[model samples]
Target: MFNMILRVTENPVRRTTARDIAIIAVFAAITAALGLLPAIYLPVSPVPITAQTFGVILAGAVVGGRRAGASQLLFLALVALGLPLLAGGRGGIGVFVSPTVGFLIAFPTVAGLIGWATERVGAPYRLLPGLVVNTAFGIGVMYLFGWVGMMATTHLAPWAAIVALAPFLIGDALKVVIATLTAKGVHASYPGLLRSRTARAVAGAA
Candidate 1:
């Protein structure tokens, strides 16, 4: 019974395909492109608010869990290789050790969790549920890491770090709304995209 329940709820792991690779690459590029948007520096926090997170949310919302996560991982790999893919055109192995590392590392997890949760919402994903999933994972979970990153780098007390992180919440909230709406539109136009990878694999084997 436990196995059956797991089987029913869990996304079946499947082999990656060329299409998956293409999708991952495309989303990674989309994320990098968003970084080109001017970052808004906040006097309160060292981390600047950028549009990159919007791409992160959209990747998960549109691509489902594994691919979304893969896309983020790919993006980071390029950044790590010294590509100026981050906001303010900043990138390199050095960025990984900086105050923003926690938030930066959280990208893949954020996208993956959002994608997985979005998939559970099923086809024709609606606006409210999408908003809820994106908000919870994208902002709440993502910030949890960001807070730790701030503390680690700046040596701030927990409360102090939380206070510093407060300024970005409003901006993240807005991104969540826009990403959710955009994802809903995408799913509406490209039905089954959330399940595309799995569906394709199943179809191919038949």
Candidate 2:
């Protein structure tokens, strides 16, 4: 019975080891820490510029889709639980109803999508394609959600929403560039950065 239990527990193909859970937790903590960075608030927009995007991109690039999404979910859970883990050290149930809430809720999806796109770039980690994917999908999608949320919450016209969100575009684009370069450097230094366990399993079989 003990042997059978060990086999069940240690079945690498069927389960994540404690190490994986711990690593995911660490990434979640990293995401939370990034949110603690100083925020620059725009007078016209409820969204504040923060380093959280950098963490979001890095988490996805390093952890792949499922784990990256898990990490983001964990971070959001912390915020939902009333931890001051959001930008400007703000958190709690109140944030859920705030204008920026849609963007907050979309974090996991954005990370997962970014991870999926980055994985398709294959080996050697070509910089440009990954950069473009991260920019177009990661930051762009986030802004879309945020803009809609702002309009909905503020009852602003589309043009007003666009004007309010415009200030963030250039800064966010710079963040995407930074995240892309960072991901490229990590991939070059650690060639296994983007490899999923499923890929490893298939490769080992072949």
Candidate 3:
């Protein structure tokens, strides 16, 4: 009976088209929900510290590069439509014009990059390695867009722009560490939960 149950649990027959859609939708909703968490306002800047970093990293780790990027793009689209879905319930096209806008635009690309990198690592998960890669790539993406956006939108000189961004750097690094650990934990617990595409390919072959 134990062997039979194991066979049933591992049955490839469980894979289905609807299942893939449902899984992706669920992860997308999770990403959005993480965005809605309360934020810590920074008096120095309009940018607020929020759990959205978790959402961003989770997208890459759980959904892989392509769907992860798609999920972030969907979230951005919602924001563009004037939904108060961003940090501190702020959103709209106007937000895109703000100094923090570059960070917003970098979200999808960072997710894709992290996802792609993690996939290349080819392991269950290693916290230090994941943390290092994610911290570098995620922060690099944010700063690249953020500095340019700040320079374009605000009166701050280059040094001031660097100063404005400096305060958030440590916090962002902490978030990256948290995200890396979270991803590793989820991966260990649910080995194949994120394999919707792979399952589909196998199902097609069968």
Candidate 4:
């Protein structure tokens, strides 16, 4: 009984259908577009407050883990190949060495982690609970990566890095709220929004 239950609870094995690929690509583009929106650069750091993280959060709740991670990977790949997809029109391999690289590195993991959390939270995907989860894991994890990157690049002490990041938290908090609402709204209107092809296959197998 325990073994059987484990199979049912496992991450669904997703087959990458054409439609799935398209949806993933669309989210990647949406993230890139958000980066194109105006960024408010703060005096304290090179990183700016932008809407890209909103896209990241949405990808998690809407696309599920593996695909959401894939989308961010694709975005990063495009940027590395010298498309100015990042905010401020910055890109290229060199950008990977920038202070934001830590946060950039966390992109795939952050999306994947949030996706994992959303699935665990189950149906109806309540906003307050989702907000709590996103705050704890999604935003928290990214900031951890972000400040580490800042510390390395700027040669700041760990304590100073944390202090430097304070200004951006408020805007990021708003993004957490927006992301939760967007995902919840989609989930309400379209059941099985998080249903993976893997989940379908598992059902078929069962």
State the C-alpha lDDT per candidate: 0.89, 0.79, 0.76, 0.82
Off by over 4 Å in 1: 1-14, 40-48, 196-206
Instruction: Please identify model 2 stretches exceeding 4 Å from their true place.
Output: 1-15, 39-48, 196-206
Q: Model 4 over residues 66-125: C-alpha lDDT tens digits? A: 788889888889889999988878889998898778889888888888888887766656
Candidate 3: give its CA RMSD in angstroms. 10.2
How well does candidate 2 match the true structure, expressed as C-alpha RMSD? 6.3
Which is the leading candidate under TM-score?
A: 1
lDDT of 2 by residue, 1-206 (tens): 85785577545545666667776788889988988878876665565678787888887776677778878888889888999987678889888888777688778888888877777666556678878878876788888888888888889998998887787776687778888888878877877766545665578679
- Quick one: ranking by lDDT, best first? 1, 4, 2, 3
Candidate 1 per-residue lDDT, tens place, 15-70, comes to 98758988999999999999999887767566577899999999999999999999
The C-alpha TM-scores of every prediction are 0.83, 0.79, 0.76, 0.80
Q: Model 3 lDDT vs. the true structure? A: 0.76
The parts of candidate 4 lying over 4 Å away from their true place are: 1-14, 40-48, 195-206
The positional error of residue 1 in candidate 2, measured at the CA in angstroms, is 29
Candidate 3 structure, TM-score to reference = 0.76
- Candidate 2: pairs in clash: none
Best by lDDT: 1
